[model samples]
Target chain A: MSLKRVGNQTVVFAKPPVILSSYSIVGPKEGQGPLGKTFDKVWKDALNGEKSWEVAESKMLQEAMNGAINQASVPKEQIDFMLAGDLLNQIISSNFAARQMALPFIGLYGACSTMALGIAVGSMLIDGGFAQKVLVGVSSHHDTAERQYRLPTEQGAQRAMSAQWTVTGAGSVLLGSDGAGPRVTSATIGRVIDFAVKDVNNMGAAMAPAVADTILNHFHDRQLRPVDYNLIASGDLGAVGLALACELLKQSGMNMGTNFTDCGVMIYDESQDTHSGASGCGCSSVVLAGDILQRIKAGKLKRVMLVGSGALHSPTSALQGESIPGIGHAVVIEG
Target chain B: MADQTQKKPLLSVTAEKYQTLIKQYTPKPTIIKNVVRAFIVGGIICSIGQIFINLFSSFGLARVEASTAATATMIFLGALLTGLGVYDEIGKFGGAGSIVPVTGFANSIVAPAMEFKREGYVMGVGAKLFTVAGPVLVYGITTSIVVGFVYFLLH
Candidate 1:
């Protein structure tokens, strides 16, 4: 079985999979952000009437997934697979949502990059003829991520200037071979690149190198220049990381001018006090499902490259003196 | 944690470049504003403690007793404010000023416990109760004991 491999690290789908439907739901805080109006649903309560924030995250994913399936007008039984994840221990949010939905599920954990991984795999499944229609979703709640990744908000802890606020939202995209929407044309799987950045507070620094590496690889593999795509977007590499990524890409002899932007940088208003910018799995997911796809459909962007970046570090790993390793997966979407 | 030196063989140059870029892009806090806020907030908290001391002293309490009463009262106020979720707001605006008070200590303990209350009392609230303020208490008690021992020896 010879897969249609690009130059290296990328797979080109002969028959690209179409994104049939997509739904985005954000919490009160994220609902008030720049992309607030673009989302399909915005919950008034961050807790979503749940007991704990973790459970609330699961609820968001459940709603987003159901909403996507409904928007696609596909029966639950007809959906062959569900690929989902979140920023939680064991990805409890996606797992819990899977239990509620009872769909054939594959749980993923790519830190903030879970959405890209899900869409990439879902696209592959559809393009390879394994499934006719697949569901891919990812979510992250600020409260849940705050407690798990750092100190609880109630602790009144001060965040570093480099720290990024985890986004409170969920986004789900339905992909099928037969639908009419922006198509997933190619995917570039990333390799773990550790630059020995150990500061848990500075996630942008930790993840920027991987974003640059993957983007460069995507360009090399597809034999495309920055001018080929109308937009080159990165997942959750906030203001700092976006700057670093742009510089790194430029040093490697590729120029990404105004075409380059980041989900982290665009999601929040500057006055929102999200030190660097917004992050988490939901950051890129909501932006892609809610804003970018809409722009593409409106004939604003013809081709776009979405690079999902993740800092693959645990608290235990950081405490044990391990340098944080990062990964960035890129998926090409053509309108 | 700071002792660990970053020494990736192949990517060291890239790391150096990234560090420079991060320093350039990361926002620096307004020091004057933060210092002024901290000073005002800290001074206000201390003044409230002084008021408690004066009230106790007026009620005919001895100097040491008055100080003790004021500290206890301040601690109570801090714990109350933390429980009501008001101290966190103060903390956001006041920074170290809010944290330097007895109330900040109360906020530290109650905040984690309250957030983790969903995990259950034993592992969640109970274990996490002392996480933020534990080191402060440990060092404070240890330093006092050392000082007491030195004074006893000198006397």
Candidate 2:
């Protein structure tokens, strides 16, 4: 058997890329969430003094990139590549941020699964001897995503009870061939799964199956059980998706038990009135950089599996009466 | 519709079965609570419009003029509240109550304008000004014209 290729879809990195540093910045609403204090910086307002919400999102991503580089004590000149993505069309947030950084840019679009996708690609690059250091970043804004995906910011339309609030946040992780932080040990790339879910509001339900698929595949590939990892966190399944995912996993004879929790459900309190919970590309990214990495650094946790689920649907496609297709990618971080 | 049903077989048996499984977990909307809130909020808004009409009539305006002025006042209030970012909250609580009123019409026009203002004046605000309310106006006008043509033939 090849050293890096584990089971069917998993890639066990031979020389695992160490996460040198991670940084997260969130808007005021996210700053008030449960993992609020863990974030490195929080803007008082969503706009962050920008003219538009799109610009504000790009600024957050740029700041996070700079923050991660600075925290790692790595000079900007030494970074080999910048890999990033966001929810905006053409990934404008990452593109705009990359313009200013002037680094070797590789813009990705895995929607909400961007964090895991970025880490997987970045780790592969470092381990393959393609690059020494890679910066992976992602950002999403509530106002920006709302206008793009649903309705205008000030529109008075009532949202469905299953709807999730888009998180306004950005996170960056600096990965290197050698470092002293949590190492990305493996990744499981997911398949695009579609169950013909037509409801645009209930994204959690649409993404739940993909989340279940990736998580199940990860466990099978690694030859491990739920107890093997300190935690198994899904990207942004929210409440409905998380419950559905648990049921699906149980049916498959792989119960996640207490170690399973969703980042979407963990980000907000019940009183937040976010219906299902928080979602977006930023949802998992901020949770990972702000909460998960911090816990790993402090020796409070050891191994973690981050399964990021993404609803790969567009406004145009939905309007054309197409069902939402979901994708998920898994990354294993071990301290 | 026929084409769509014919394409249903493209979905695997597992995909079709999974759809049924997920429906059990999805929460249904509270119909009774929404209906109650809509009724109460809608009644309150009409009452406020009535108060404005009474006030305008007391100032010696004709009954029709007073009613027209009250509607204008409501639209003005809606636009103002929308600008201040308060109408969305009311719309959230009131549901169709706030939406069925004249103020809701005003909001439909102003909301898109504000959202797209970043793209500049002509292509953004002017083009998208009637985006939300356009269909309502189209159907309303088309139905009125049809009614008028039928009335003309009968007369």
Candidate 3:
């Protein structure tokens, strides 16, 4: 109960909640990536047996949550809360999956940053003694996201170099008050920063400023240097946003060094033809659940900072010539 | 145009400023490559149509009937390719070349319908079947009717 608030936008947990278990389900493309073997399940079919891509996303989340909960050895009713989100309009994938799961759901919409946002909130709930166990989930389907946010897959529109392909996958993490695993140690909530960037295709460019802002704030609030963490990961800046964020950070006299990387750039191989790289809510979610957590358990990484960034522009707003606003939330996970 | 310019100097200034800023980041289209791809694809599609027309005419059909049969055959091929998920690939490679043809019209109708087929037969497939191609059909039919009416009146 002692002061958890730190600096302007950070919260340091007095008692870090343990991540009991994590599960990730990815599509064929992601399954073909470097960390493909680490995922609990990879659907070879993009549709994943569902009739539509949206429904396929819902099913992916449902299966991910079920798998994570089962892996954690916790029954569904025992889990106190379920926090989840997706990129679809009204976040229908999460809502529909929650309906099927029948858990007490707190639906969220952080665009691509939903994973980190959910984990941060879940950590707070458990640390605050309001919940003994919490489930955090996030998902994004490339087709569904394209249909809602951009052009349909049917359109076959040529993507610009800065455009990122949304990752088709889902990931779930189960956090508990008492568990023997990596712990959620702190969180930094990001502010919405818009520098009047109105291009919908160049989301990495739109979100880079916000990532830099949150990372700087998180570092200052936590009084930690970049060398303190084994690795620092961004949500979905890809090639373009990562460079911009690093430049911005360098301007602030902070250097992340060789430890810095982005989930978007890591999830897809360059030959995959993802213009910038893999993006979406599922990018960081599955990466954290599958790659980061596994590495931590294997004694390779002791500390990691995951900064999830999201563009908050809607299609309607973009069409109306409104600038794209972006957010980034940071979570510190320690082994 | 002169009166508007005289009345709205501030509007012009703002428009110019916005235009300059947008131009900096706007992606430059590869015009030559696109034009060449479009021309080649369009020519190939038209040549196929011509072959179909010649074939039908050699079977003793009239010229108009042969042309109509060729158009129907092209549309049928387009719809079949769309169903088999090949038209999208062609469209991806050919860009406007594929889209400017009657086959592309068939593709536009079938693509969304196939995508929405999972929602249900009536509300999903049937309704969305025309979502993409609806405007073209409406305007094309309407303009043809207008032209027909005008020709009749003149006669």
- Estimate the TM-score of every prediction: 0.95, 0.96, 0.87
| Candidate 1 local lDDT, residue A331 | 93
Docking class of 3: incorrect
Docking class of 2: acceptable
Query: Which tens-of-lDDT digit does each residue in A156-229 have in candidate 3?
Result: 34567778889999999999999799999999998987756787888887887788889888877767899999
Greater TM-score among 1 and 2 belongs to 2
Candidate 2 second chain TM: 0.87
* Residue A123 local lDDT, model 1: 87
When candidate 2 is compared with the true two-chain complex, its DockQ is: 0.32
Model 1's TM-score against the true structure: 0.95
Highest lDDT scorer: 2
| lDDT for position B149 in model 2 | 100
For model 1, residues A245-281, the per-residue Cα lDDT tens digits are 8877777777788999999999999889988898999
Top candidate when judged by TM-score against the true structure:
2
Off by over 4 Å in 2: A1-3, B1-13
User: Where does model 1 sit among the CAPRI classes?
Assistant: acceptable
